[model samples]
Target: MKWLKKSVLLIAVFAVGVVSGSMIWTSSANNTGLVDPNRPGSVNDPLITKSYVDQAVAGQVKTELEKQLQGQLEQLDKMLADKQKEMDDKIVQFQKQLDALISKAGGMTVVELQPNQTMYADPGATFIVRNGTTIAVSTDANGIPDVTGGKDLMDGTPIELNHMLIFPREGRGIKSTHSSTVFVMVTGGYTVMNPDGTIAASSSMDNSDQNETAE
Candidate 1:
């Protein structure tokens, strides 16, 4: 009887072990089935490594910075263009003013002198005898400058018709020859006087103003 009882106990322990093993194997199989073989590391999809997050953030920052820098460059180009245009406009304005000032300063006119009449010129006056006979008269020996002929005219030198003459200093003049009515084009300042040295007509000028009288 004792031997049978021991054998029965051993059989019972073996059967229980077999049943427990079978149940444990079934539970393990069920847990394995819950995990999809197709989805490997996707179990925790939201979880990412520090290196991967840093790379993603850096790429975004670089893109944003590039956009900002491009916009700044474009703005700078526009500002420079505007400034250049403004400078161009200022230059044009200054040119126009300069032209007007020059025109007013060196205005040209025609003067008529009768026989024995004299026309006294200020320094740097230009003259062109258009018609009739005339003669140069100067207080000093330096005389009047014949710009066209490239020579100087002393006192009583016959004025050449249609030649450009520049008076170098004050007290220099031209007198019409006897019985001739002289017509002359004049620039800068001058005064026409009758034979008695009385002023007939005069143009206003500053005595200190000097012009480049030579070509």
Candidate 2:
């Protein structure tokens, strides 16, 4: 009888433990299911939201586009500067060439004469005679000489002798009997002779015509 009672008591205790364990497990599972769905580590939790991902992608794309546009603008600016410099250089070269052509066509030639040096002039040419820092005579188209424009000779200004003393067709060409400086302008070449009548120098005349001045 004593053994039978003990066994029944042990079986009863074991059944009670099983029932309590089952109830505790059921309650825990129910509480786990009721937890906030949006909490971290939950099934419905979002690692990265849709809106955030979209904004990030848009920002990245905008940055890239801006960089590309800046690069293109820089390239264009460089090209324009290079072209402008090339054009400026070409213009300068062209002006130089034009000036050279004009000088060869019709330019003035200055001649310095020693004392008693005679310069023969052409029949229809003109000359400017200066004696010791003074324009003694300026000849006209008719071989007439005068000192009309000599009073306005400013210091450091080039003395322009448009027309001056003329030499006769056959006489002692500008005898220069006295010491004098002579400037001669003619359509053809002329001969400069020393007092001994020997040719000292000869030169051809060029026209002084300029359309525009270079910068």
Candidate 3:
């Protein structure tokens, strides 16, 4: 009976150890389910769905397309600005050339005269006498004198006279010294200059005419 009781106690202890080891093994298997390939809902399972992959790929492609579009737009803006500047430059150059042409077309001509020299004047021309020299003149578009380096002459301003008229000296009245009267062509009509340098107009002078003057 004692041997039988010892044997029964050892059998009970072995059965308890087997039950405890079986419980520990079950806990370890439950913990390892997250990393196991054979278990469902584990780390090795495919987590990336088709919808998620498609969305990621679409987002990357959209970003690349947006970047390329922005680059093209920037390049187009630069090209337009450069073309506008080039057109503006061409317009400015054309304007300068046009202005030069107009200026040249509207310019005037001048002729210098010496003492006792006679020159035929145009119908719209003027005669200016200054500093022992005479000048035939015309006006520009601005009605300004067209003589070279000359300005509008004003009396009593201490300014140099660009145009003058003949005035006899004191006690020397003009008298005829030639056999025939000398003719001086003026703007509107012919002027008769006596041998003694006296001047007479062929017709009545008009004050409204720029080229017509009375001295």
Candidate 4:
């Protein structure tokens, strides 16, 4: 009976030792909260120091600070752009005031460029105004000319060359055989005009004026 009691005591002692070790290990490792510093995740001993926690915290703070600084810089850029626009408006206003003052003082105010007027000065532009013809012109995004139309283009916007003024109601043609000849789009389809102004080829459109445009 004494031997039996001794064996049981030995088993109890072993069990208690295991439980105590586990508790200590869990407490040390759980407290390392910061990236398992102190090598707290080591299989041997676990537990981190204040230094590790501080370093990890510092790194996170630096990241957040950098993001904040970058946002501030973007905002600053937008502010500068707004300020620049305001300054430009002021300058334009001053120029107009100066022009008015000169005219009031009886001095000839030779205005070079007016706010409401634009001058075409491209030497390569062509001005071919037709008394009885509609104008066909190229356009930019929103229907404005990207490049200056011939010297004749009005500064405002381009008129689409989609109708009889430029196109053949419902026909195709030898757009231009010459290097780049502008074909006069005829309405009621394409009709090859005879020397005497007669229809050579008829497209048979009842009589609409939609036409092909230049690329």
lDDT score at residue 100, model 3, on the 0-100 scale: 49
Under the 3 Å rule for N, CA and C atoms, how many clashes does model 1 have? 0
Every candidate's CA RMSD: 18.6, 18.1, 21.3, 19.1
If ranked by lDDT, best first, what sequence of candidates would result?
Answer: 1, 2, 3, 4
Estimate, for each residue in 67-179, the C-alpha lDDT of model 3 and write its tens digit: 99999999999999999999977975674465445436644222222234333333344433222322232222222233444554222122123332222111111122223
Q: Which residue pairs come into collision in candidate 4?
A: 125-151, 126-151, 140-144, 167-211
TM-scores of the candidates are 0.45, 0.32, 0.34, 0.33
Q: After superposition, how far is residue 187 of candidate 4 from its true place, in Å?
A: 51
Candidate 4 lDDT for residue 179: 26
* Candidate 4 lDDT score at position 209: 29
Residue-by-residue lDDT tens digits, candidate 4, 144-193: 22233322232232333322122211221221122222222222222333
Model 4 gets an lDDT of 0.41
Clashes of each: 0, 5, 1, 4
The parts of candidate 1 lying over 4 Å away from their true place are 1-106, 205-215
Give the number of the best model, judged by lDDT.
Answer: 1
lDDT value for candidate 1? 0.80
Q: What lDDT is reached at residue 15 by model 3?
A: 100
- Candidate closer to the true structure by TM-score (higher is better), 2 or 4: 4
Scored against the true structure, residue 78 in model 2 reaches a CA lDDT of 100
Candidate 2 clashing pairs, residues 3+ apart or interchain: 106-207, 127-164, 138-164, 139-164, 139-165
Per residue, candidate 1 scores C-alpha lDDT tens digits across 1-215 of 99999999999999999999999987887688864544545554555789999999999999999999999999999999999999977975674465446546767666667798898998888888876799998998888899898999999999998898998789998999958556677887888777776666666622332121110
- Which lDDT value does model 4 have at 64? 100
Write candidate 2's Cα lDDT for 169-199 as tens digits: 4322343443444334333345566767666
How much is 64 displaced in model 3, in angstroms? 1.7
